[model samples]
Target: MTSPFDPTPLPPPECPAHASGGAPEPEVSEIGPGGLRRLYGPAHEKDPMGLYEKLRAEHGPVAPVLLNGDVPAWLVLGHSENLHMTRTPSLYSRDSRRWRMLQDGSLDMTNPLAPIFAYQPVCVFADGAEHERQRGAVTDSIARIDHRGVRRFINRFSNRLVNDFCESGQADLVSQFAEHLPMMVMCQIIGMPEEYDEELVQAAREMLKGSEKAIAANEHVMGALYRLVARRRAEPEEDFATWLVEHPAQFTDDEAAHHLRLVLIAAYETTANLIANVLRMVLTDPRFRAQLSGGHMTLPEAVEQTLWDEPPFTTILGRWAAGDSELGGQKIKAGDALIVGIAPANVDPVVRPEPSASMQGNRAHLAFSGGPHECPGQDIGRAIADTGVDALLMRLPDIQLSVEEDELRWRSTLMSRHLIELPVSFAPRPPQEITGPVIPERAGAAARDWQISSPRRPDPAASGTVPQPGPVPAAPRTAPPAATVPAQRRGSAPVRAWRTLVTWWRGY
Candidate 1:
């Protein structure tokens, strides 16, 4: 089932560029079903930045569209032409094999947009010096991490998931705290085994909702990451799947389980849709809840204004071209594909013309995307979304929202916009005194050795409240002890044959 669109031909003697002769076949159309209901309707899932400002005022800075309705491609939408096509990888090339409609097979390799533009072997589907040796073993194992031990392992999995719904004062917070605290701190930084955290967050959330059981949920998360790289090569710990099976880019154990399934599916799909779109802009925007409840916004300025006005990956995948150029003014050819429009280049009125009057001293945002395959663990997905939005604004400091920010809903998909649930409400407090030891959730290997020694979690570099520049240390206290869970697991033999292969692969 390899077709996440594989093409591969632009290497060796660098040959394939042949389409010039009479330079024509470009402007596509077929987008029917009433133009795919005006580009994925429900008003483009509740105003996709007003449909990227009406497709950048009628297709200006590179637009073209279609996908699923016909398949076309090219998107970009300015911001210095998506930073010169993602910092010029020699005229664009994050290898979607080297597309030309999946190299002339004319697309549709079981298209449901084949689990995000197909071809996966990780290091974001390599290119040039094999994308710097699988992105230098993921930026040198995320630069030998420590961001205050990732803000105390995301404040002990955001206070053990807000003490499992903080005594029912109401919650949903996107499936109990922004989709299971970044996939349980990416299965405790890939050492996995907390009895397979809800089967790897339900097989990476139905293989990122491109479902139809997305290729058997991407082979049940690549057979639980090739059995956690064969139990960290027969038991070697200190996580990140034993630092990518003891990396130095010697890979191969299925290339360190495809770069640990590309850093655990890009840390559970773009850090849980960027901490559920900065908690839906701090509970429905009223100017970021009066500048995040008055201390003038900081949780890294509401995650850099939610990565510059709403951006949990607004498309940045396919980028093929590499030959007959022109871009922004159109003509692209050689292989074609493109994309990048990251929410229309972060509101690009010729490069952010007063996008919300320059979001509090802006921090240029392609949302951790740009250049030689950007996002080397975007500062550990912004320290697990600024320590799970500073552990729900320091333990639900009077939370809010139980509905009506125009009654939410969004989640159409063709590259995430997320929020199929947030629901809120607060004023509960009290439950925060657990010092540590609580195991017993079918105590398998004593609950994966108490999530590998109670959040003594480390790996993910840091620095003073996010202006960023590394060298860490000093930040520890991760909460975990209040228990009560039972979805079964008990004893071992590789977690009872990996919980009978995730209950016989979810009985289907």
Candidate 2:
């Protein structure tokens, strides 16, 4: 197996000093303690729409602000500027290693943002040919996934989850259903057994909090991937893990582990929030609810609207300046740290004067970052969210929030904007009989040996954060349909990658 970290030559420099062509230096306004508190503190976390609006209106699209009230970074608040920075990767690099704060040891490695900004062996951190290599491998494997099979998997899991609390007449949808459904779908996609679902859920909990426990959480997830890789190598099966192992990239065992870890977590986090946000919209706004049932808005349209208004991810990790540059008339010096403000950029009044009206059918949001480093799993992520939401709506059409809309809470994190819990109530219904073909049991280790010990769990209460629930033990899962794709063809990675992006563009 070849090392997946193979480096590629850098592209010719597209940005140079004085690239702004004598534009006056824009005052880099620091986001003082009040600003930081307002952005990631409790008030902003609850509903960032107002904060983003204030920032964009007061500071223009691109403004400089202190991260955590100390770390200086530029927040790209406009849609056009966000697109310019991300689309021009040569000008703005994704390589976190290039971040001057990390190099100078000013940034603490233990900082909660480390997981996203710190260097990792996977493609998300890589650039140039290396990015293409790892990205191609991921996109090619993703493109091979049968679309209908993915929908079936989501439906089965969604149905299984809904049955868990249907008799209770009330449940916290976020903890009980919205959160766990995506994790189960991701596990099924990666060929993990059903039994380890609890452990993975716990790992996700730790990973999101991002402290000392984050270190333990990382190890826990990697350990599971290692064991899964060994099992697949010993007994190859029809799953993403197997395809990754046999792909032309020939990723080494460790390389395979890292990439699989990335895929699982990315797939789980993005889709989970996507499903939750869409459901929240469906439950909160009677107008939106009527639109859905009246055929005025489709599930995909709902998903699209959520992506624009409340993208799963609010910010992308720091993209450092390779050389001094200017964006939207703001002079960005070399080595300046820039964070893509997804929430603000998506609603920039300049591009989207009326954000709500623009999203009726728009697909031009930066929820998924653009350029060489765009998310490779977006196609299936959308499928998973759409299918899961569709299943819930079809099953529990009368579901409504049990609590007042204002009473719901959102998690406080620098990188994610997730609802902590969405309590909802619905009329009870009798369980349906299992009539589908006898769903086959999963094939993997029988014991719980893969559950690695970790450091002491973080105190969610100490931080005033609510931990999401573990995966509800799913019933026998319906087997997904076989992949409709043929074996890998020559030079197919680029094609597959292109097809996935194009699909995202046209909303096919």
Top candidate by lDDT: 2
Instruction: Assess each prediction's global lDDT (C-alpha) against the native.
Output: 0.66, 0.69
lDDT of 2: 0.69
lDDT of 1 by residue, 1-508 (tens): 1112233322222212222235653433323322422344355666666776777787678876655534566677788888888888877887788778776676645555666778877767677788887787777666655544445556666877888888888888888888888877776666664535766687788877766676787788888888878877776655567666666566888888877777887777888888988878776777766554444555666787788887787876678887878877777777778788787788887766877754776777787778888788777787788667765655665677888888888885556688889888876656675444322232134322222332322333432111222333232333333222111112222334433432232221
Consecutive 10-residue window with the lowest summed lDDT within model 1: 484-493
Model 1 RMSD in Å is 19.9
TM-scores across all candidates?
A: 0.33, 0.79
Instruction: List where candidate 1 sits over 4 angstroms from the true fold.
Output: 1-47, 51-53, 60-91, 94-126, 135-163, 172-176, 183-189, 192-235, 243-248, 251-265, 268-271, 274-312, 317-339, 342-401, 405-421, 425-508
